[model samples]
Target chain A: MTERGYAMPMRSQDTGRGAAVRSFLSKSPPAAGRSRLPKVLTGIEGFDLITMGGLPAGRPTLVCGGPGCGKTLFAMTCLVNGASQYGEPGVFMTFEENAEEVAANVASLGFDIAGLVAAKKLAVDYVRVERSEIEESGDYDLEGLFVRLDYAIKSIGAKRVVLDTLEALFSGLGNTAILRAELRRLFAWLKVRGVTAIITGERGDGALTRHGLEEYVSDCVILLDVVAHEQVVTRRLRVVKYRGSAHGTNEYPFLIDDQGISVLPITSAGLGHEIDEGIVSSGVPGLDAMLGHNGFYRGSSVLFSGGAGTGKTTFAGIFADAAARRGERCLYFAFEESPQQIVRNLRSTGIDLQPHIDAGLLRFEASRPSTYGYEMHLARMNRDIDAFDPEVVVVDPLSAFRGTPTEIHNTLMRMVDLLKARGVTALFTRLISTQELHSGTDQGISSLIDIWIVLTDLEIAGERTRGVHLVKARGMNHSSQVRQYQLWDGGIRVIAGAFSGHRKPSAAPVLIASGKPAAKPKKSAKKSRR
Target chain B: MNQSLDNDGAKPAGTAAHPRTHYNLRLYVAGQTAKSMAAIANLKALCEQHLVDQYSIEVIDLRENPQLAAGDQILAVPTLVRHLPPPLKRIIGDLSDSEKVLVGLDIRERAPS
Candidate 1:
């Protein structure tokens, strides 16, 4: 009673009394012909984007998932985020865990639940329904729960509510008919109360919830899945149904870590990014010479495909270094090599990536492709991209994604889309087996990129020479002839051969001998004849 | 509101029917609807048949005392809570299922010796 009395004017003060009266005046459900419902943003990453704004305000959103799939955490984060970020008061009523347990669990995520509770911004109430505690002897209804919930809500003037796992009612009260009827009433009552709520339920064998709570909460339903693909677990979220709004219907990958749940909703922001016509170099000495001497278009996707030891990594390193040298941030994702290994290997070519790293303009994220599922890698990449906000992103050797070709393509497409929307130039290096080079299909991502630079080895007289060929550069005049290049102490340089001349020199052997050796070849042949 | 049915105001304080014979029953209803009326009538008839003239029924309407619902842990409408006869018992429904209600309230059998 004391807490309830104390909370009466706090919510009014927070939202202002005048606004409350106006909201109460128009509290009826929208007209039948209305298609869109007002939404409340939870501020969860990618969630608002996928839902096309957020959850329908003043309505319940049912979140269903299997065990340990972050149902409770998702609901808690919504409340926490709503209260802290959106300035909306919330109440978390747990039928399963107590308030302290919920608070302690999310403490690592930097959510000060206790502080919010004390500030009257949030109210966490644990509704216990023990089978051994109460007896039902006559015709009765669950007026008790309604009263408690109402009290909690009014005390904090909460605009948001979370019922973490409503399955406890079924187990605790063993009367399905009564509980079912009461739950329906509770949902209706919550709607009447005009609070945006989240009701989490456990996944059933066939339906969304074991108790079929979906029947009662039909406004919005979101399903979470923890899919284990090849021993790597990936969490995916899909909006099953949003009653009156157009939402993203794809299964978006979400990550739950120290920052809580972050969903990677691809393209929900749409592809209408403002394009920049600026051009940036590829970091190679003569590589820009092929593209009408004007580097690549800014924010465009570039692909570097080549066989092993064809200096594809060297090309990616040079691009990243060049970007960093120009005072632009570069994020290099190395799947096959460690950061130290990339630094050491690129140093031998005299590209010197260490200064960029020291200047805080260059960041190298190295990991093994087998470390997690492909979706998990994409989720992590999305997170890192958002945090780093780099202007140029390089994924060295895109072939390292060990998933199926379709999965790799989808992931790369999503990655490029996100980067393009953010106006970040992307460079991907793909490894192609020597046998796959002649089949005319250059790695699987050639069609998805704006620029394709193919690197191959030309085996001439028992010597393998590296050749750089600009197969396609969209919207620019590009050379069609292969230019043989050699990696030296400084960098990859175009040899002073006949084909090195731009504009497709009259078809030659496309081979260049290393310096001083090919110059004295005739003299050596004469000596042998003597 | 909160009232007892067919009782003439307050009775004598010590008018215990016969110790265990006095049945103190509380029926929680949301309002005076058809279902609530049916539950009230059915409970009175069953009490008359079993504990005749010894039972007292109290009706608490949620419209009047919404806060009281939490005390008895009432989740379903038209719930009957047997307060007297030592151990408490609860039967939920409109009281249409007479046999189930009797079995649930342990009224089909005599009190334990």
Candidate 2:
């Protein structure tokens, strides 16, 4: 018997495409004579949103992760939440910990486990796999387990299923061979009966699932990891594989709290937001004059594309502070630094988000984009936008949204549409490659927006100079010449093009150490080399 | 809560005591094939062997006063109620299983409780 766990070959390598076709067919509405099929939501926040109405109705998905990274907790939370939140009853089968202990452990997390069970919204059966309990008797099958599950499901007519760490079947059962075969049969049985299932596995090094059941069941596979680097402990999720849909490969940071997990995406922070028409300064009077009679549309998207360290974030901080000074709300989602670090950096540029934070006018959200799936990141931003409700939404650099084009396009398009509809003046600073700018083509976003500002760093004859120029302003006439912009204590100062040495600066350089000349990002360099 | 029986105390009731006295039970109905007709026939068959009242029967046609079926548990057209003893035992169904109806209502052969 082949011991490969979850050994289903990738669809790309499948023989007749029969299974995919059949799976697709099965997903359509059942025959007209059939009654409605029940699908229970998986309680993980935003999970339902991404799967676009939750895991495909009744199919089983494997949530695999290393121990202590909250593997079982993830599965348990789904069952507990399903019953409590959605009124969809569920049954949890544990092959690892005993029932009482599992319940107690989760109780600390504030999940009303006992109440749920007493209400009969949930059923927990711990399959005892202890060493001395069973005799390795005759051709025994998992018929008993299935029978118990069937009875429990019928008792309350449960619609959700969770099998926690089925690894115990390796030892508790009479034979591994029978268990494996039965496992496949069990998934088939669940499909026929239509119960949305979540089966968990311990994280394994090289396989999709622990103990190798990865290929057998599960339409999706998610991984959770606790990354402790430099004393920062963060829990992040990466959609290792979502078989049927497009998912983000990046691991996104998430917070586990009394209300469960909340994933944060900073760029999506100010979306779905409404902005006040109230006037605020851009910290630059001349540029403001060149922009409309006021400064940049009150709630329009402003992009400042410049080469490295050209004060992109610094300029945004000043605008953010300007809004704060006027008592207008501003939310700065710094993808690269913590709010404190941002405040410290901003103070040097002459604006502070802290006092406003104290006054409750300005807020900051920061996270590495690599920590979560793209959609999750975007969804988290939408959530934050609702909570913050900022009039001025500033994303330090929009280039991060640029790395993954399809998602970036979708995410940005939705974001732009939302910002415009809400009338929240939005600011996005993008670092364009020198090549993209010099070649006389707008960086991708030029077509998607109403205003574009080209910020440049002129490094000539050894001196580094910076300039900001407005290329286009939608529905408004704006500055058309290259001008000098400086980050001073408390704000940015803008003047006609600098009167210093000129290197004829191009796009921004990728952040590098030593503050020495930063190397162009390899991707950009490759394009230039080509 | 009695230790001797599960809830509802499964007990046999309405058995015949006098061998000479036949319980003379009549299950009134319009005719056979109707639910009431079946109930009447089923009751008579059930009592024949089990009850000391190896009863006789009479059929009453109530398709005219269907109103009377409601007073009884006659939601269905056919219903069988043991009318011999003071209290009645009702069973609904075609006279499919004679023994089940008798056992269910505890129509026992004459035996003291």
Best by DockQ: 1
Question: Best lDDT goes to which candidate?
Answer: 1
True-vs-predicted CA distance for residue B47, candidate 2, Å: 47
List ranges where model 1 is wrong by over 4 Å.
A1-36, A267-274, A496-530, B1-113
Fraction of true inter-chain Cα contacts (below 8 Å) kept per model? 0.41, 0.00
Q: What is the DockQ of each candidate?
A: 0.26, 0.01
Model 2 CAPRI rating: incorrect
Q: What interface RMSD does candidate 1 have?
A: 3.9
Ten consecutive residues with minimal summed lDDT in candidate 2 chain A?
Answer: A1-10
Shift of residue A243 alpha carbon in model 2, Å: 11
Q: Where is the poorest 10-residue window by lDDT in model 2 chain B?
A: B1-10
lDDT of 2 by residue, A1-530 (tens): 11111112221222221232222223222211121323344545444433333455677778877777787777777777778766778888887777788888888667777788898999887765543333232132354456556666876779888888787777654457867887888888887878878888877778766678787775777778787643446777776766565434566566554435644323322334454555445645545655654577677788878877888888788778778877887767666656677778877865656777777777766666565444544545544454455778887766764345665766666667556654678888777777878975454667767678787877666766677777898776665666655565535545433334454334322122213211222223223222
Predicted structure with the largest TM-score when compared to the true one? 1
Chain B, candidate 2: TM-score: 0.51
